[model samples]
Target: MTLTKTFNHVDYLWDDAHATSLGDDQVALFLYRSNILGADLRITNYGGGNTSCKTIEKDPLTGEEVEVMWVKGSGGDIGTLKRSGIAGLYTGRLRALKSVYGGLEDEDRMVGLFQHCIYDLDSKAPSIDTPLHGLLPFKHIDHLHPDALIAVAAAKDSEQVTKDIWGDTMGWVPWQRPGFDLGLQLERCLAENPGIRGIVLGSHGLFTWGDTSYESYINSLEVIEMASEYIEKRVAEQGDKVFGGEKVKSLSPEARKNQAAKLMPLLRGLTSSHARQVGTFQDTDKVLQFINSYDLQRLAPMGTSCPDHFLRTKIQPLVLELDPQEDLSDREVILAKLEGAFAKYREGYHQYYEKHKRANSPAERDPNPVIILYPGVGLFSFAKNKQTSRVASEFYINAINVMRGAEAITEYTSLPRQEAFDIEYWLLEEAKLQRQPKEQPLSRKVALVTGAGGGIGKAIADKLVAEGAVVVLSDINKASLEEAHATYGRDQSTYAVCDVTDMASIEGALDAAALAFGGVDIVVHSAGLAISKPLEDHTEKDWDILQNVLVKGQFQLAQASVETMRKQGTGGDFISIASKNGLVSGPNNVAYGTAKAAQQHMARLLAAELGKDHIRVNTVNPDGVIIGSKIWEGAWAEGRAKAYGITVDELPAHYAKRNLLNEIIRPEDIADGVFACVGVLTKTTGNIINVDGGMATAFVR
Candidate 1:
């Protein structure tokens, strides 16, 4: 197995899981590692496996340090997590308690269990594993049942097979409900194998750790990749069908095109877009098998790679049957069999819940059997969208292939279903839902962001679109506008050219955008110019240019888009792109800094005036972001680089060192911040989010 791989990778593996939690760092990692631990498990999605991080910080109420741990929050997928995504927990008291043995028997007592660890009393509850993570000795841990790893571990000779591959670097324990018992077993395993780099829970998942988050994250990816490689080799020698599902037979490009047209209309109502998309994959045995599992329940518990697959794939797949191939005479008989199978599965599911569930009511989700397999023909996964279907199919197919391989050693078995129900109905995992907001978050909104050429603007635009609103890209650069149009343009997206700082330019863009894609919903005035210069070398001309480009430019777009958005009768969203220089000032920015700061306050005042109209206004102040923009390249373009007293390479470094992330911030990152303002944070008013990657933290310190 390759020992190392570069980072910069992310994904959602929870697309298959129905059981998930928002708990302590260790617990979060525990769940994540379960997927990574074995070949039978896998986490893949736009929202994949769930994970959390934990640490101790000062309690806002007491102004004293508390044992706070951050677990992955409910909605944000593991592949794309930030600090806030994790739920906070108090470890001190959690450590003091052992089990639910004799505490207040009711759930309310358990709720108050960690009251002492809260940073904010009004904040979200700690993850379900607060007690588990608190009890564990490892400072940082992870739990995942990576599909690749699960495929291997789900076999009868799993332990011996793992030993042959990993040698003494790993530990294996039988799967148990993820609670006091699992935590206790893991503790014992660590005690036995002090040098354990990671652990694999039989019929469950994997665990990997390090002294720090990056170290642990990197290691987790490595070990998981290794396991995936092993799964690939084994499956290659043994299986058929992939995410593209078992291809009936390859068709010529012309024939395939026609087939795609027919399939498009049939699958259109499954997702947001009705238009069929054409994609092809080959040779990736994992993806193929991952796409072809007909009976995930019979193969292995492939509902989710982890516990959080419920949000993405719902509960399960639509399972159908196969029959006499080409036997058109038996079509009626096949339909009767299909109907009977669904009834059996649904009745069985109800019985499973009634047998073990002792807590909260379960969501009355769809149970139309997401998996459609014709026994001899192939399997298909049903979903509201094709992407979800593809992801589910991939995970299911891979797990089944691995399970088939396991049959070579002994009788195939699955983890206890009753226990799965407990987790599927976990109370701690249910808290995130209890705290959800009352609105649809992005309820009444539409937005248009200018200069969505890439980077911050693009990130913000993506965020807006993701939150269920339409977006229009306004840019003077035709090439940039087209790039965005091609990249993000869909039914909800539009593109137009309008150089900010010019009225006609702004008006034309406004008209084209509104006419083609309904009307403006919100306005993110992100189009601006950034020119860094020292005060001594700066001139009046520089000052005017900076003010006109950065300040006047945003005002022009907000002026026009705001009126159109307001006409929607749902008010409007007006946001401006500002800089940290406006909040605390920056070094040598001079004119650029001055104008950026003015732009921020301008938005603040605008918010107050527009409050009467129900229009929300805000500004984004991101730092030194190189988001596919000329300004980024020009920031260190030549003589200026020399004047900064460093090589051109050192310029970005010097700037980046000033931020907390210690990395160059990208423009898309900033755009995401802007999108959150209009999208998720619609109730927020007059806010300024610093997308400076921690530069603002330096200023705070």
Candidate 2:
């Protein structure tokens, strides 16, 4: 039937011309359909679903036409799927494996046999869900985890709801771990119920198929639209009684955000006792609504029903035990409660592992919650890196949506604990985890670099990001900051405008850092300006400006950032990009030299004072870094050149010749020195490294 019904929730993005252009290329059409379906989070979350198309292809070896199945590969995301990201397997061989299958005990062994059926050796490795798509008797199949459908699937009377919605048009299958066994069940359901268009896998997702690519795409959308309408109508009937009504009023936007910023570092620290973790905070309307509900304590503990949701968010979240309305404003009270809650959570997680773990199961993972729900505040998710953390928050939000819809009609239900434990510690899942690339040195670390729009600051920021840290590139120059921010992916870095001399401006940048990627673990003081003039020619204005930006600016930035680091309680690095001019006395550079000297000493003083908090402070000194130095682009270059009786253009060569190594220093050279202090010299603090091509005159005394 033609799909002309208007959709109220999901968008209809199918363009007839686009599909027609892809003509008869079955795999290409499959990818086109998968991309569109994955583009909307309402359809499925990132890396949560798989799709496949069966095509007739000539075998490279036999040179005869054979049925081949092309499906999304292991660890692949349909949203960004490409030709190389799919695995092509011989369809007949996959179906033939049914004869040798050794029942449920051999499910994992069955996964290993699929590789032998590879139609193309160069294709990506197949995922565990490969059999589910290959055994289905259809040309095109879509297996998606849409929240609307999952809501119905995760409800108490899911099978009855399936019958109520589509009667005999759709079938139902109970919860089963994805593998060879589940594939057989789906094939059997279709065989028994001929002419059924799709099946709702209980507490799992939706499966739909058609004879053609367009037909399959439309069929999936149609099912989701009908489910969305059903849920919306039921929610309307339920009214505000959803989640048993709000237990506490939501904090004002600003107040809630302020509270989140204050709490994120503490949470990051507490949860990171075993392994350091990056965090993401969400105060969206949906999250706020759930956290403020009376049933939050009861429903959140039941955990997420869908495997895709729990795999990222864990089985359940740790609901902070504090009355937001009363304790949010009291720091001491909140801190005391948070400590107790975290201790309790760790003990409970350990108990969960001990209760459900099998003899052959992989050892228990970190005994910490991935998702944290704060009443009257919002949600906080933590993981090994920024992207995972952010995606986990999204998955939990999806779970929240599923719970809302299910509760509006029938009671919401999560997977049984035994089933959840089996899926969680599955040997196949453990193998996948082991296959992941080793993390970079700065993984799970967040940094804030001042004056990062260009030159040394930008170079340092780039280096930190390359080593796997999410950074906030702060600069007063809007145009330059935007330019720098564009070079990195959205997840890798963000830009904030700040004047380091202003405490409020400095704090604002820290807030951006906290909101962007939890909180800062590395603070690089790289913002500065230089004034070069003879002692007699120097004006008070020159002195004030230099000291304010270079010396006082460093002090204020450190002062503001240390508070956040202290809250995290996770030892951090404070690297000051000071200068050789601080140690060396030079002519016509009185104001700049004095400011640099003060900056160096301030770092030392702070290093001594903040040592108890495990905050290491250090400095990198670079001399005559003319190439790509912002300070050298202005009058400072000409003034220093004139003092040395050389032209501005000749200063770089002149400085190179003056150094002991006779090497011209670049911005990248200074960046290497900073990385050494943060990434390499972890145990050594309150020290200075020189990136000045070995200048004897500037040697530390």
Candidate 3:
């Protein structure tokens, strides 16, 4: 059959030349097919679906060719699947479990037995859907959660729709939790209908297979395309009647984003009562259409249909009760309504847990919703990190597409609450959660580091990110910012060119922080320059430069950052990288010293003022951070060295000798001091931590 076919939605990505390159390796072909299917969200969500191929392999133990099943392992995404991610099991051993199966109640026990069937000792653990593939007679199988097919599957008349779409060429199975029982049902469905090409799993997904990997892949695309064409035709007939038509108009792009920026921090603060969360904001046209629709109130509460959707997005989203048409400038009103809405959402979640939890169920998870919807603002999704939060948003958009199709053609149906709870609270899933790695110290925190292009600034940014904080690297120099950004890449850090002296530049950087990773949890004011000169030699320009960059710059950054932190209602940290000269008097350092002192005192004042808001302000004083200091690579170094009667090259040794510990302070030392202020000194504020290797003169008095 030709691989090319036109479809309104979904793509035909198969390359015959690439498939042939694998040289008849079934496992490679399986991975290729899995990747192409998973590449498009229209096909399946991240980590949502599974693929399998039964292959003949040489048994390490028996030294004989034996049939083994290789399937995408548990908790792995098919788009990024590698050889190590697939599980290999003996086909005969997997089949033998059917004889020992004691019915639905025996499902949990069957999962443990799959280990005994391992064909490769180093294979990844098999997933819960193992039996769904093992019992099927096809050599290759593709099970996916395509929104088009799921629209048909989640419709009120799902089974009838399946019959209408494929006309007995496809089979339909009612909702059953994935396990041996569901697998048995699939085997029986195929057995009863000898020539059916695939099966539409009610309220779940679709499964199709073939003797060859190419055939199985094409079959899945064909069925999904047919379902999409059917849904599109019906939706066209319904027209504006879909979702009861739009009730509210979408905000202009700028207004919509500004609203999201204002709302995300507040939502993050509310949802983070249990554990701090990182957030992602999405305002796609489809998202706006759904959120602004008349049926949004009714449909959003009905929750997502597919297991993958709810697993990432929670059972249902917490919809804000604000009207988009009303003036959003009234912060007090918005706050009051938000507080009430969140309280009710938490109460409802508790009730859900109480209603369906079993005696053996894991303790109720964070009751806060993972997905939050605003009528005019679109969606905000929160999780432990950026990628996960982004993926959650993508999954919800898929749910929206499914709802669009289902509601247009037939009534959209979610999985029954009890069934959803069973899967969500399954003991097997609880065990899986237990196996995940522990979170890093700064996980779920976002930090914005100014002057991130320079030595001290770059070190601070690197250290914060290494501890699991997503960072925004900002600098006055675009060249330095670009270079620094390249080191961390886009996942952990984003860059903004900012000049602290410019309030607009500072505010723009904070906006970048808020939009890039929800909001800033920590702010490091490390951007500085030194003008070393005697009181008489100090030019007006020198004094102004030092005062503006050091004193005024820190003030503006703090001012802008505080707005975001206050809106977040989450406590935050502000660390000023001051100098020991701020405390100890030194010759030829009049302008720099006075400016540092002002920066230090300003931190103390802010610490006292912002305490009620739970914002901590601290200072890190370093005597000599000259090794990689941008400030030292200029006239300031020569002036300071000349004042001490030494050449610039002897400055490091001279400064180290003056300190009690006699250690040369590096940029990393300053970074450590900053980390201590945020990560270790959580209860510390209005205090100075010196990273000058025990400088007695600079000690806090």
RMSD to truth, every model: 16.4, 1.7, 2.3
Give candidate 3 regions above 4 Å deviation: 1-8, 15-20, 325-330, 641-664
> Model 3: per-residue lDDT, tens digit, 284-317?
9889889988999999999999998898999999
RMSD over all Cα atoms, model 3 = 2.3
lDDT of each model, Cα atoms only? 0.57, 0.91, 0.90
* Candidates in descending lDDT order: 2, 3, 1
Query: Which candidate should be chosen as best, given TM-score against the real structure?
Result: 2
Which candidate leads the pack in lDDT? 2
Candidate 2: minimum summed lDDT over ten consecutive residues — where?
A: 323-332
Q: Which ten residues in a row have the lowest lDDT in candidate 3?
A: 323-332
lDDT of 1 by residue, 1-701 (tens): 22334422223233213322443445445345434322223433334344444566776667887766555444544554555556666666555555552532444354465565555454444544444455555556665546555655666677886786688998888766555555567778888988978887776667777765445666677777667565556545544533223533334444333332222212211211222121111223332243344434344334433343333333444443332143333334533554576677666666666777674656633434444433323444544333445555555554454455454333344545555566666665565556756534443344678778765676777777666555677777888778777875344467877778788888767655433333455788777766666778778988888888778887777787665544333466788888776766545677877898789878888888888888888877776665365566665344446556777666677768867778887766776777677767868888777778776442533
Query: Which pairs clash (backbone N, Cα, C closer than 3 Å) in model 2?
Result: none
TM-score of every prediction relative to native = 0.49, 0.97, 0.94
Sliding window of 10 residues with minimal summed lDDT for model 1: 272-281
- Cα displacement (angstroms), candidate 1, residue 334, comes to 12
Ranked by TM-score, the better of candidates 2 and 3 is: 2
